[model samples]
Target: MTDFAVSYFGGRVSLRFAKGVPFAIAALVIAVIVVGITSLLAGSYDLAVWDIPALLSGQGDKTALTVLWDLRMPRFVAACLVGGLLAVSGALLQGATRNPLADPSLVGVSQGASFAVVSLIVLWPNVSIWARPIAAFAGGVCAAMLIQWLSAGKRGENSLRFILVGIGVAAIISAGTSALLTYGQINRASSALGWMAGSVHTASWGPCAVLAICAALCLPALIWVVRPLTALRFGSELAIGFGLPVGRAKFGVITLAVAMAAFAVAAAGPIGFVGLLAPQMAQRLTRAGVGAHLILSALGGAVLVSAADLLGRTIAAPIQFPAGLVSAVVGVPIFVLLILKRANSSQL
Candidate 1:
């Protein structure tokens, strides 16, 4: 799996693979470049790939420029921001909870966001679209706060216990969302389901503007959380011993993570597993601990989500799946492999 090129048919139809160290190093660079270019170039139109230079110089055709500037640009920017948001939230959650499986969605963040959106659609169907992100952000952070409280001081932390609690909370909220939609007076279930699945199909400058503003407001707070995050890894005692304001810091981080998840969900309907996969992959690739460079993890996240989105759109063509679906289908196996690897190593 380490080898880059595999030859067959007299080396005429060679295949290639990348994994482990070589994969991490080479893939990081290639992923950054490929994701950036492909993300910019992809869309409904047929632009000349070689004509990228003209577009960069603002000399491309009007239609091509429209595609690049209007349609593709916002979506591409969203992919990067939403992706980074989810990944950072994931890394922070994992570090805070000292759980490899911790993610924004797991602590009911996604469910909370979904609930707020679904309620908006059902109770106030005529409400303007501009307000959905606001509601979702409010609900998601509240849920995170609640979950953090519940999980606090729980020792050796049974991962399954956390998962079960999360699932239960999520299930209840999901049922509430469904109930709101199913009510004859307000059957907005379809909208709820769609949002739950995650899609950026309706992405535009509006949500993009909101996302950017939130990122600017939230990134500094997130960075502050990172320092405490490192202290948190050796358990809350050491964190408090280091004079880190453990409880307040954890609350702040969970709140920000919730907001990030909510913003992403509002913009792209709860894109699953980006949070779960990105930091884990970064760790595996760099052999770094949870407290490693936040910037690298963020970039890794952006590349992953961007590439997955590209794959989602291109693989099926006219009837492409959403990027979120693409991640679940692709990410589940990798998640399993990580679990199996951990289990095997533990027994040995």
Candidate 2:
């Protein structure tokens, strides 16, 4: 489809999107809304679909209101926020690194955040849950810095080196996290395990607000990176030849990505594969500019996570599965298919 550009702010800001992008984005938005409504209505504590209007209007049974507002609503919101953040993060990483397989978990952001949050849980159980995002952000930043330092040298940045170093760092951090889980107190470790499993069942309005605030704060950064991402995709040398500050742009993109992933992990634990899969899904759905691609990826991620959470809670009735587990189960086969597709393309 052809592209259309819209100018705003006296032409200082413009967004270009493919003709099909709007349709794809609308579809994803509808999917998210449907998943969210279904999540709110279907659960162990039944809430009739027809009563949703009354309940939302504040005229429902007290118990139903409590279940809807306090439990289901927050969980659904959290899933959307977390999924959107992670998907955007993954899109950024893939663009910045010029690696189709790059994602938060693959590149050490999730593991770093997990390490910090798990340490807090296992070592200082009395700390407020609100502190998690801060710790996670710090850990993720450190990890990103480490990867950058290790990957850059006399020849400048190397995408392959970056991915390799990040994989090694992620593995080390994951090992540390496992050790903490293994040696820590059983009760605290169990609590940490539940969070690490990536279940949003315990999500409340507090964490939901935090995730929303983080997403809002990242909005400008997202817009700023669109051009850089598009340029970077053509290769670092070409980006530099085009008068872009390749190093600064790459650093900024990676930092933005890390922050997004860290916030999501802090709020809902590390939900796997959403970041990895969403961008690919978006790309396959429509050929669009980076801005529209990111929008599609975020919406796709929200749908994936919200659906995963819905299925987790409803599929087995009272026996709930963690959304992470379900997403992995669904994502792994898709991931394998992506790998095979890439391999076949390279061969051709």
Writing each residue's lDDT as its tens digit, candidate 1 over 1-348 gives 443566888987654434344446556767777776887777669776788788878996898988887777677677877888888888777776776776766668888898898888777879888788799889888777666556544354555456456767777787787778677253466666666677665577877888789788887787577578878878878888999988887777777778778888877887777888888878867554333445556777788777877887888787767888888887778767765665654421
Count of backbone clashes for each model? 1, 0
Task: Give the 10-residue window scoring lowest on summed lDDT in candidate 2.
Answer: 339-348
Top TM-score hit: 2
Off by over 4 Å in 1: 1-30, 149-156, 184-188, 287-292, 337-348
* Candidate 1 colliding pairs: 198-269
TM-scores for candidates 1 onward, in order: 0.83, 0.93
Model 2: how far is 335 from its true place, Å? Answer: 2.5
What is the Cα-based lDDT of residue 28 in candidate 1? 72
